[model samples]
Target: MGLGIRALIMVFMTIFTLTSVANAAEGTATFYTPPYVPSSCYGYQNNGVMIAAASDAIWGNRAACGRSYRVRCTGATNQGVPQPCKGTSVVVKIVDYCPAGCQGTIDLSQEAFSAIANPDAGKIKIEYTQV
Candidate 1:
């Protein structure tokens, strides 16, 4: 390959890698059973099944409300399931607080969790990005 062509390829590869890294964030996720209403951000209002609760790390004093995040399961958090990801992603709205002692970084609704990972896994490693 010509020197110029090789340099161009390297530049494009660098840009692509950086863009992917900038958009994704690693976190742990767990599913919560129904009765998703009466959220701390929205009281008794239904926000659909594609909803989640932000952990203290991203709660930002309730600033996370109404925000949407795209989440993909990366792996299982335990040996109960060696591979939990279904090779899909789910976009969920932040409608509540997961609290300081929340078991996961984001508490996803059962439907949302099932979209990305097996519900039986309970908790899984995830890659997410605000959208």
Candidate 2:
């Protein structure tokens, strides 16, 4: 194959990968402070920006530890402290697994959470893509 064709193939693959990731993430989002037991797949931390996802069929155990994703809150809140969505997005590292009975698809650290949302809003709808 020619160099130009090979480059085009690589670009197409990248776009396809990103599109798949974006479509896979469509659920609720919330934030939290750490210091929990067993730590996360990347070990423990009480501060800094990060996020967690469920260890279900969607994201396998410890598989997403070092990955980053761009998350965007897509709508206005109807719950505690209304934070109207501004379509802003933030990239966060995956550091842990979602807590049992957690209320969202992804749980972010306060720093990561505040990047795309107002601090007062406890939960919001979000769409994310791996980066």
Candidate 3:
């Protein structure tokens, strides 16, 4: 191949690689919660913490909550895919606090928890990019 043509191809390849790297740096977080309020009064609402059990199949009975997270959703796993989280982004306020030894990352509300996790699965993977 001609020197000029080879040089042009190299330039284009470099640009494409750089752009992909930049996009991968972006990140988000997500969680799954119960669909409706539980019959038992075992839930709490702290200053920013919210915890509730799922009435549906996704997270039935098993407790899942969070203290703080960036994003939450109930969608397919996007582990390798870039920016998999999608749906309403809710701002959680810490009204109360969870005691020691809480299982999950954050104690989320019924609505917040349900967004990213299947009640049956009871757990959702979260991703975030540090600012």
Off by over 4 Å in 3: 1-69, 73-89, 128-131
What lDDT score belongs to each candidate, Candidate 1 first? 0.93, 0.70, 0.41
TM-score of each: 0.86, 0.67, 0.35
Model 3 TM-score relative to the real fold: 0.35
Worst-scoring 10-residue span by lDDT in model 1? 76-85
lDDT of 3 by residue, 68-118 (tens): 234444344434444333455444532223344444444456555555444
Clashes of each: 0, 0, 36
lDDT of 1 by residue, 8-117 (tens): 99999999999986789999999898899899999998999999999997899999999999999999998756798999999999999997789999999999999999
Give the alpha carbon lDDT tens digit for every residue of 43-70 in model 2: 5453254555543423566787767788
- Model 2: which residue pairs collide? none
Note the residue pairs that clash in candidate 1: none
**Best-performing candidate as measured by lDDT:** 1
Q: List candidate 1 stretches off by more than 4 Å.
A: 1-14
Off by over 4 Å in 2: 1-24, 34-38, 45-47, 53-57, 77-83
